[model samples]
Target: MAQSFQFETSTERYRDEHFLPYFRNGVTRGPMTAETSDIDGLADRSRTPPTVAVVDAQSPGNVGTIARAMKNFGFDELLLVDPPALDPDGEAYGFAGHAREDILPNATEVSFDHLVENYHTIGCTAVTNEDDHSHVRFPYSTPSELPDRLATVEAPTALVFGRERVGLTNDELARIDEICSIPAAADYPVLNLGQAATITLYELRSLTLTDEETQLPDLERVRAPEPTIDRVYDQWAELLEELNHPVEKREKTMRMLRRVYGRADLTTGEAIALLGLLRRATERPAEQ
Candidate 1:
């Protein structure tokens, strides 16, 4: 069943008046369009990644999945509120994969109030209001926008996810400083608890991880140098010339070869091998 909640506007005025201007400006808008200046200003500021917090989570397996997602995204700290037993031998531990060694075992159990008081809490929800009439879910940032919204802050923060069944209560969301939502079809926006957590964490990974930390192969290392690529083009021209490829058509053929090689993004080794083959073709006696 999709978890849906009706929110009251009793606290809307309070949030508008008390919270940061960014939040107020975000109301009635999608993805904080008017807050670009605010976000850009904070772009170079120090960043402290938020702790992943699950509230009133009923499923141990879901909790484990969240932990694994955290590990994949370079986040470590986790806080649980009213969580089920995560026995070492149980589903939580079993599903945690490598995270059981660190994120799950070291998770802290804290009250919702404690989470709010100690950190800048951003609640994750699938539901949101379209207009400024309600503050609880309106003016929410989508998960992809979180890194920009949070890039400047240095304070401790928590990315709060609610129960698998009903999600966070309206009251809990009312107290949260900000709201983050994953964009989905309007008719059925709800996502599985673990999937929601995973997607949100993946979006926020830029704040927690550096390019070097990800250890992905550098493009410079894999791609042939411009000079090397030029050599391949030169070789192609030579091969075409040796074949008595018509002079009028040779230039066009070379142009096509350039386009093909440009799109291929051949590696250095591949380029060298192609150069050798082209040389051999050019050197071979004309087949008569």
Candidate 2:
């Protein structure tokens, strides 16, 4: 049996009772009209990424996994509609990893209509129409394309996913402003709820994360300096000479060593260690 959908008529009461308090601390939600400009400037305003909303998610563990994925991609605000009970010591918290501390605990419960009224809702679905004849799911954007498409909009947005089994019904998709689908093999395009959210969040990471925030190690700080690298090459040459490498092959061997080192992207410490080992090898007497 298909689930019935209804739009909530009392918007202000719902917003006041359920929505406003969750955002009072730091999350901002309001209409972003043309005349309304953020006092912090557009760049700062655009930094606010889309909220992640799961509609009628069945499993607490899946919800937790989605929360974990949200943390991985720098998104914090999560909205749930008919979600499972996330006990402190339950699978939801266990699977949430670091997200249990913030994302899962702070997730707000909202009605589907609250999302429609308060946000530019983008429905994520595996099933899409093949042609423009049906507007409900046609003209959908892939997850990778969302960043450029949503770059300038300052309004609050929501990436809405539906139930694990049926997903969002036709009626719900019809009400959503936009649709986003992940491209997959024709035989099976559907993904696990957590997987779908993770992939979509990853593709949209550029919207929420900065270059400094995403990089693992500061490349400039770790890369070996030019002089240090030169010393490594010099040490290699000295070691080769000490070993009495073939005269004709020495230059080629040195060139090969340079290529290998160039591709290694060795850190300053690694270069120094290599230089030390080479120096010791060059100075050590051959075994009699």
Candidate 3:
């Protein structure tokens, strides 16, 4: 890869005449990690190709469906979190069909903490919004929006799928970096695991790859974690209150600001600048 990071939207290979395609490009043999036994088939976990992580799933059939979807979408790394141990001879193989032996056989089982510790970025799937406004998983992004949201992350990233029945717990969702939702018919919003996985993978593939001919202005990209964003928002809240902004509107105003900052996708420096701006504007004896 020309750049340290490789970007691919979905199962399709993004090939440019001027740039080497990741799928067909030089894959020089590399050494494995010290913890190599736990992670399968990857030397550089940081630049993990698009991956899928299953959480507490019960169905072998669904896992098979997911594996088949992975094959269709060009995803190879699969992670399982407390899911029913895969039955190799079961419907999983039947559904995986061609990918049955190759990708499915290598799926790794890890803890929720393991995912948080390893991947550079993590996205969890959900059909409904969490009731708590302050939940880390809140302010969800659509599957189609995910690739753009994570365009800068060169390290390994994963899209996590929860159980068919209840989906991800708030705690599980908390450990993730973002939520990728599938917008659907309001009357029946949710889809089955297989359907959801396929749609998500397809949208991920559908993103237009940037090329030498592509017209775009590159900005200063930065990585700001949720915790930092929250701290900045809290400082903003103090500023709003100092200015006597109505109590009824405080939460709403904070939310709007969060959306503004979140959309900007500021780096640590950018976030710090904004936080300092608010403190300076609201400087008072109490605040000082």
Candidate 2 residue-wise lDDT at 41: 36
User: Please, what are the lDDT tens digits per residue for candidate 1 over residues 244-282?
Assistant: 889999888888888898888899999999999999998
lDDT of 2 by residue, 258-280 (tens): 89988888899999999889999
Best by TM-score: 1
Regions more than 4 Å wrong, model 3? 1-47, 130-132, 206-288
Q: List the residue pairs that clash in candidate 1.
A: none
* Arranged by TM-score, best first: 1, 2, 3
Off by over 4 Å in 1: 1-47, 185-188, 217-223, 242-246, 277-288
**On residues 122-158, what C-alpha lDDT tens digit does candidate 3 reach at each position?**
5555555665567566678788787765655654467
RMSD of 3: 19.4
Candidates ranked by lDDT: 2, 1, 3
Winner of 2 and 3 under TM-score = 2
- Give the TM-score of each candidate: 0.74, 0.73, 0.54
Candidate 3: C-alpha lDDT: 0.69
lDDT of 2: 0.83
Best by lDDT: 2
